[model samples]
Each structure stands twice: as C-alpha cells, then as structure tokens.
Target: MKLVRPLPAYLVQRYHGWKATTFAENKSWYRRLAEDGQHPRAMVISCCDSRVHVTSIFGADQGEFFIHRNIANLVPPYRPDGDYHGTSAAVEYAVTSLKVAHLVVLGHSGCGGVRGCFDMCSGHAPELEEETSFIGRWMELLRPGYERTAGCEGTEQRLRALEQQAVIISLENLLTFPFVRAAVEEESLTLHGLWNDIGSGGLEQYDPESDDFLPI
Candidate 1:
C-alpha cells in the first residue's frame, strides 16, 4: 500500500467536476441503485483497450449492463481446476447469480491484444515467445483464432478475420461451461458475438446460419 499514491490532480479535478454535475443530477438514481442492487439485462465481455467504450457504444445507463474487461476479451474453455480464473469467476457470477439474459463477446478493430497474438503466432514477436511473458501466455488463447485465419491472403484481411475470430472463439468457449450450456439449453440465456470498426463506428454481428459477421 505504501507504493500507492494519491489520485492524479487532473483526475481529482475531473471527479470533483462530475460530483458537482453528473452525480448531483443523478443522486436519486444512484441511491435507488444502491438500495435495490444491480440487475443488468446483459453481460458484455470486452477488451481492456481504452478506446473501446462499452457503455458509450450502447448508450447504456449505470446498471443496464454488467461488463467484464480483459486483455483481448477472451474467454478460456471451462476448466474447474481451482485455479485463479478471474474471467470464469465473472462469467459464473453474471450467469448464475445475476441471470443476465444476454452474454456478448465484443471485439473491435485495431486491437493491440489481437495484433500481439497475430505477431506471436506468426513467429514475429520473439519477446512474446518467452515462457515468463504473461501477455504471451494470455495471447495463447487466441492461437486457434490465428490458425483459423491462416488461409487469409493479405495482412489486413487476415488481421480483421483474426479479430472477428477472437469474438467467435470466446462465444464458443462460453458454451464449455456447464452453467452456460444449461442456461442456453433452457433458453434462459443467449450468446452474441460482435465486432466493431473503431474508425467508422460500425458494428457487425455474427450470423450463425451464414457463418459471417453481418453489418449491424
């Protein structure tokens, strides 16, 4: 705790400004949320990238969506081995405890994590090849996605394909969880995969029947 410092002056100033305006205006809503507890309709698994604003994108209110963020929005296959599984824990809580109706795996263009996975899988990033590299280990989850796009011709095309594949991979992995599978089977939960074009602010949703992402 000694290593921790006070909040940056700029952030503190911004917080005070928000407290004077946004928080004051929404004080009643905030109090109601505190009293009633959260009951978000959907759970969004998105990347830790700062540019990808989940709430802003969806125009969501404070408790409209339960969100979990990670390196690449990746969800590992279910393995209840009693290890530290942060993502799995969140998934379990969202599904079993919160009973969210929709679970979305959202990917975006120009994702650094996806790019790192591509470089690592292509043998271009030697530093990531190190056994001790945390990012490398995490990116391993996307190796299958890289393989799926290996046949893609151009780098741009391949990268885009891999990015979309990341969402698809996560959606597929979500089903490996017994709870997730059961919920889906009972028609209590639904899974969705989405890819966003950061520059254009366009969205594409995965279509199971066509096996492609259709513009949304």
Candidate 2:
C-alpha cells in the first residue's frame, strides 16, 4: 500500500483528451452501455502484449467482447483446489454468467512469454528455473507446448509453432472445465484459437479439421 502512486501525468493527459473527444461523441452510447450492462457475444483471452490490440484487430466496439489478458494468453487446466486462479475465474464468469457464445484464445508472433518458455525449457534461462520466480511458474504452463515444437528445424520456425501451440493448449485446457465442456456439448458455445503476426497484421485461425492454423 505504501508503494502505491497516482496515475502517470502522461496517462492522465491522454485520458482527458479521450474524455473530451471519444467520450463526448459517444456519450449516449456510453450511457446506454453503463445502464444496460455488458452482453458481449464473445470472450477473448489474449496475450498481455501491448502491441496486440484485440479491439482494433477485430474492429469491435465497446461491449462487443469480454477481454481477459495474461502472459502468453495461457489457460491452466481445471483444478478446483481452492487456490487463487485469476484466469480461471474470468473464464467461469464469462461462460456461466455472461453466457458468451464464443470463446477465443488468441496468441501472437514474437511473444516474449513464449520466448521465455522456450529458453527456460531449453535450459538456457536458469533464472526462470528458480522456484521463487513467479514468471517461471507461470511459464511452466506452456512447457508442453515447447515439447510439441522442440523438433522444428529453426529458431524462428520453432518459436512460431510454439506460439500457436500456446493457443491450442489453452483451448484444450478450457475444455477441462465442466461448465465450458457442457456449453460446448450443448452447442451453445464454441471455442476458437487465433494467432496474429503483430508486425504484418496477419491473422491465422485454428482449423480443428485440418489441425492447422490457416490464414484468415
């Protein structure tokens, strides 16, 4: 609590600018959203990378998508051990309460989290091997993905494959939740995996039939 500080001056300035322009133009829309509550059609679990603009990428408006961001966009397997699980909580709320129709796990190219996992699993990042490293523990969730892509021919190829695997792994984990599985089984909800190339703005979606990420 003692370490807490006020918002940065630059961010405050930016907020004021937005309030004057965007808020001013969309005042009624914002008011309606506030009064009606959110009814997002989809839940997007994406990487915490600043460059990955989920709203801009999909051209979605406010209240259109329930977004949850985390390192590597990972979703841990369902374990009702009474432990604190932020991502799991969000998924539960989105699926049970919000009743979102689609759940999307979005991964991206050149993800630092994936690189850290790659390095850690490759035995290069000893620091992440330490038990006290929160990042190390978090990145452990993606270790299986690293194993899947370990035999790729080059660094770039392996990294890209691993990135996509992160999405696949998360999609698989989502099914471990009984509610999510029930929703999917009832055909009321669907799961999707996507990988974005931040530099080129290209998007690829997972095709379960082909077992590949095809460009969209």
TM-score of every candidate relative to the true structure: 0.98, 0.97
lDDT of each: 0.96, 0.97
Indicate the TM-score of model 1: 0.98
Give stretches of model 2 more than 4 Å off.
none
Q: Which 10-residue window in model 2 sums to the lowest lDDT?
A: 142-151
Candidate 1: stretches off by over 4 Å: none
RMSD of each: 0.7, 0.9
> Could you give candidate 2's per-residue lDDT for residues 146-169 as a string of tens digits?
988868999999999999999999
lDDT of 1 by residue, 101-187 (tens): 999999999999999999998899989989999999999999998988979999999999999999999999999999999999999
Name the TM-score of candidate 2: 0.97
Assess candidate 2 and give its lDDT: 0.97
